[model samples]
Each structure stands twice: as structure tokens, then as C-alpha cells.
Target: MKPIEVKNLKKQFKTTEAVKGINFSINQSETLALLGPNGCGKTTTIGMLLGLITPTSGNIFINEEELNYKDHQFLNIMNFASPYVELPKKLTVLENLKVYGRMYLIKNFKEKIDQLIEDLNLKPFLNKRTGELSSGQKNRVSLAKSLINDPKILLLDEPTASLDPDTGDYVRSYLEKYKKENDISILLASHNMDEVTRLSDYVLMMKEGQIIDHGKAKDLIDKHGRENLEQVFLKLVRQKNEH
Candidate 1:
């Protein structure tokens, strides 16, 4: 069974339908990207998968079992990281990691935290208050907390946002190495076309709460007679506006 599967999943807020019967899946060790213009329901879909938002209809399956939003065991194996979600700002970096590690009930928590510190180069500000860290520093800490459980399914929203080129490349390369070394499935929502091209195995292009087009990134580029993913994205979005 796929690590994650969504069948006609949908969410409605008041009279607005934020997600309109979307269907997709992320297989073992594969990365699937949700590409869309702003306000196209990417975050809403992620929220449903994370069980933070109850779905209006349809179902989500994890490891062949229908998701039981109340099951802590299922939640234990899944984790998410987004710059938009903030940890307790008053807490220090180390304190934040400790809190999340405890929340996940990780065994050997000290060792796990230490490893993440080393991996993410977080030692410099480990004792600094999370609210005081630079954006890039906070981003690394967010990533560290997400991996505290060594999750099998990871949801990343703009994982490389607000980083210098060198730091951003490091985070991408680290994700590649980490996924290879561990059993993980990733769902990525990113506006960085180059990042998407380098990282995702498949792409789903969404617009107006619907998937407008999808394929392997290169295939999508070729299908639209474009040179790269950014060009293809522009073509699809612009064409829709012209309609």
C-alpha cells in the first residue's frame, strides 16, 4: 500500500470550497509535489492530511488503513514542517526540540536531538530563543523538529524558503541523503520551480482548487513545448487567465 492515498478528498469553508475532490498518493520513498498558484488550496490539502482540518467528504489512507484522526500511533509515523507554522517563540532552539521530541515520545531522545543538531548545523544557536533566530536559522530548527520522530511520511511546505543559496542547496542535498538513508515518503508544495525539478519524482499542477495538469516534470515541460518547469507553470497559469 502507498504511504499516503487520498480519494476524492475535499474541504469546504462556509460557501467556499478550498479543496474540490482532489485525489493523489505518495508511494514509498517517493516525492510528489503539489504545484499551484497562491490560494489554490495546497495548504488546505496538507492540513487535511495532517488531521488538523477535518475533511468535508472522501477519505485519506495511510499504509492501507483508513486514517483514524484520533490514532496517535498513525500520527507518530507522520510529521510536517512549514515555515508558516511557528513553535513557541519564547522557547530556545534546544527547548523547542526537546518539547517536540517528548511529544513524539522518541526513544533515546538525547541522541536523536544531538544528531539533528549536527546534521542541520544548529549548534550555533541551539541555546538562542527561537524568536530571536534569523529566518534561515528558524527554518533549520523547524526541520529538526519535524524529523524528531524519524517519520515515515513527511509533508514539507516551502522547505527551502528564506535561505541563502548556499544554505538552501545544503538543505535540499540533506533531504536527498536523508530520504535515501531512511524509509520516507514526501509531499512537497513549493513555488521554486528549480527546487521542484530537482526533488520531485512526480508533479501535480493545481489551479482554482483543481488539478489542471500533471506529469513528470520534464514530461510536462516537453508536453507544453517549454524549456523548463517555470516556463511550463507560467504557460498553464497564463492560459487559464486568458480563458
Candidate 2:
């Protein structure tokens, strides 16, 4: 069983049809990139996987077990990180990590928190309120919270957005090393083509609530006769619009 799998997933918000029967899976120790334009159902799909939204139809499997919304034990093995998702503004960085660690029922929580603080360089502002941190600092804290559980599966949405290039690169490099050493699976959604190409072993391109194209980033670039992912993305989005 794959670490993450979606079988014929669909979501309908009244008549909007936010997701249209998509299927995909993430293997152990691999990263899959979900790429699409704004409102192309990327967020909706992630919402379903995270159990934040009920799917109108279809199923989700994590660690080979079917995920039921009411039974969230499966979620202990999964975690998500997003720069756009806010942590408690009033809580200090250490306080926020404690909250998430407790939520996951992590044993040896202090050890885990300590390791993450050092790994992500969060020690300097560990006692500062989350809202007071710069964008780069906040991003690191979000990442540390997500890893508190030492999850088997991770979902990241624009994990590096709004950071200076140096900070962004640091985060990307950290994720690469962490994934390899921990053998975790990742499902990443980002507009950063370079990030996607570096992190993803497979790619799923969505359009209008459906997967319009998918393959290795290199394969897609070569198939589309483009030099890189950004160009390929432009071609796909514009081609659909013209039709």
C-alpha cells in the first residue's frame, strides 16, 4: 500500500464541482507535485486529503488504511504545512510547538521539539510570539510544527512562498534532507517551478478541477518541447484557454 492514495476523488460544493474524480498516489520516500492555476481545485484536493472537507464521492487511503473522517488515528501519521495557514498569533514559538506535539500525542515531545528547533534554526526566536516573527521566521516555525509528529506523510502548500531567496533555499534543502533521512512521502503544491522540479519525482497538472497532464518534470518539459516547467505550465494553461 502506498503512503497516500486517492481513488476517484470528487468534491461538489452545491454545483461548483470543486474536484472532478481525480486519482493519484504517493509512494514511500517520493514526492509528488500538484501543479495548476489558481482555483484549479488544488486546494480543494488538499483539503480532502487533510480531511478538512468531505469528499462528495470517492476514498482516501493513508498508509494503506482507508481514512474515515470520524476516526482520525490515520492523521497521526500525517501532517501538513502551509505558510498561508496561520498559527496562533498570541502563542510563542515554543508554545505553538507544544500545542501541536500534544495534539499528536507525541512521546518524548521535548526531544523532538529540541531537535526541530536546532534543525530549522528556530532557537533564536523560540520564545517570541508567532505574529511578531518575520515571514522567514514564521515559515520555519510552521515547518517545525508540521514535523512534530515525525509523520510518515507530509503535505506542503507553497512552503517557501514570501521568503527571501536564501531562506527559501534553506527550507527547500532542509526538506530534501529530512525526507531522505526519514523516508517520508510528500505531496507538494507550489507555483515555484524550480522547487517543483527539484523536489518532485512525479507531477500532476490540474486544470478545471481535473488532472490535465502528469509525468516526471523532465518528461513533461521534453514532451511539451519547453526548456523548463514554467514554460510548459504556460503552454498547457493557455492551450486550454484557447479551446
Candidate 3:
């Protein structure tokens, strides 16, 4: 079975429906990109996956265990990273990781933290409070914390947003390498077309709370007669709008 699965998942907030019965899954060692414009239900769908926002109707299965607000066990083996989410402002990088490590009941805490520090090159500000670090540095730290549990499943939203090209490239390459070595399944939601093309094994394009298209990145681009993902995204959005 795939590590992550969603079946006819949906969510509604009062009078509005944010997600219209979408279905998808991420396999072991696979990366699925959720692509769409702003307010296309990407965030809402992710929120449901994380169990932060209750789904009006649907089922989420992580490692074959159904997930809901009351079932917190799924969290032990899953994690998420997003530029919008920040580590404790007053906690040092090491402190933040240590907290997460303890929560995840990680064995060999020191050894694990040391290895992650080395892997992410976080020694420069290991003891510095998170708020003191620059965006790139914070992003790396967030990524490090997300892996403290050695999760088999990861959810990412604009993970490299607002970073410089070098930093962005570093994150993309690191994710690629990490996924290869650990066989981690990732669901990435990002507006950056280039990043999606580089990382995603499959793509699901959403609009108006529904998946309008889904396929390999190259196949979608070719199918739409677009030069690249960005153009395809534009064309899809426009076409959906015209309907």
C-alpha cells in the first residue's frame, strides 16, 4: 500500500465548500505536487491531511491508519514544512529540534541531532534563537525539524519561497537526495513551476475546489501545447475561468 492515501476527501466551512471531493495518493519514495493558483483549495486540502481542519466528509490514510482529529498517532510518523510556519521565535535551533525529537521519541537524540546539523550545515547558528536567523537559514532549520522524527511522509507548502536562488537550489537538491536515500513520500504544494518540474513525480492541478487535470509534468505541458509548466498553468486557469 502507498504510504499516503486520500479517498473522496472533502471539506466545507459553513456556506462555502473549500474542497470538492478530491482523491489522490503518494506512494513510497514518490513526490506528488499539488499545483494551483492562490485560493484553489491547496491549503485547505493540506490542512485536512494534517488533521488541523476537520474534513466535512472523507478519509485519510497514512501507513494504512485512518487519520482524524482524534487520532494523533499518525503524527508520530508524519511531518510538514512550510515557509508560513515558524519555529518558536525564542528557541534556539538545537532547542527546537530537541523538543521535536523528544516528542517523536527519537532514539539517540544527540547522535541524530548531530547528524542533522552536519547534513543541513546548521552548525553556524546551532544555538542562535530561530527568530535571529535569515529566511534561508530558518527554512533549513524548519526542514531539519520536520525530519527529526525520520518521517516516512512529509507535506510541504512553498518550502523554498522567498529565498535566494542558491538557497532555493540547495533545498531542492537536498529534498531530492533525502527522498532518494530515505524513500520518503512527499506531497508538495508550491507556486514555483520550475521547482515542481524538478521535484514532482506526478502532478495534480486544482481549481475551484476540484482537480481539473492530473498527470506527469511533461505530459501535461505537451498535452496543453505549452512550453512549460508555468504556461500550462496559465492556460488551464484561463480555460477553467472561461467555462
Please give, for residues 124-186, the per-residue lDDT of candidate 1 as tens digits. 999999999988898889999999999999999999987889888988999999999996999
As for model 2, its CA RMSD to the true structure in angstroms is 0.8
Off by over 4 Å in 3: none
User: What local lDDT score does residue 86 receive in model 2, on the 0 to 100 scale?
Assistant: 79
Measured by TM-score, how close is model 1 to the native structure?
A: 0.97
lDDT of 3 by residue, 1-243 (tens): 788888998888898889999999888899999999998999999998888999989898888778858968888888999999999999999999999889889999889999999999999999999999999999999999999889899999999999999999999999999999998999999999999999999999999789999999999999999899999999999996787
Point out where model 1 deviates above 4 Å: none
TM-score of 3: 0.98
Task: Give lDDT per model, in order.
Answer: 0.93, 0.95, 0.93
Worst 10 residues of 3 by lDDT: 62-71
Off by over 4 Å in 2: none
Number of clashes in every candidate structure? 0, 0, 0
Q: Give the Å shift of residue 242 in candidate 2.
A: 0.3
1 versus 2: better lDDT goes to: 2
Ten-residue segment with the worst summed lDDT in candidate 2?
70-79
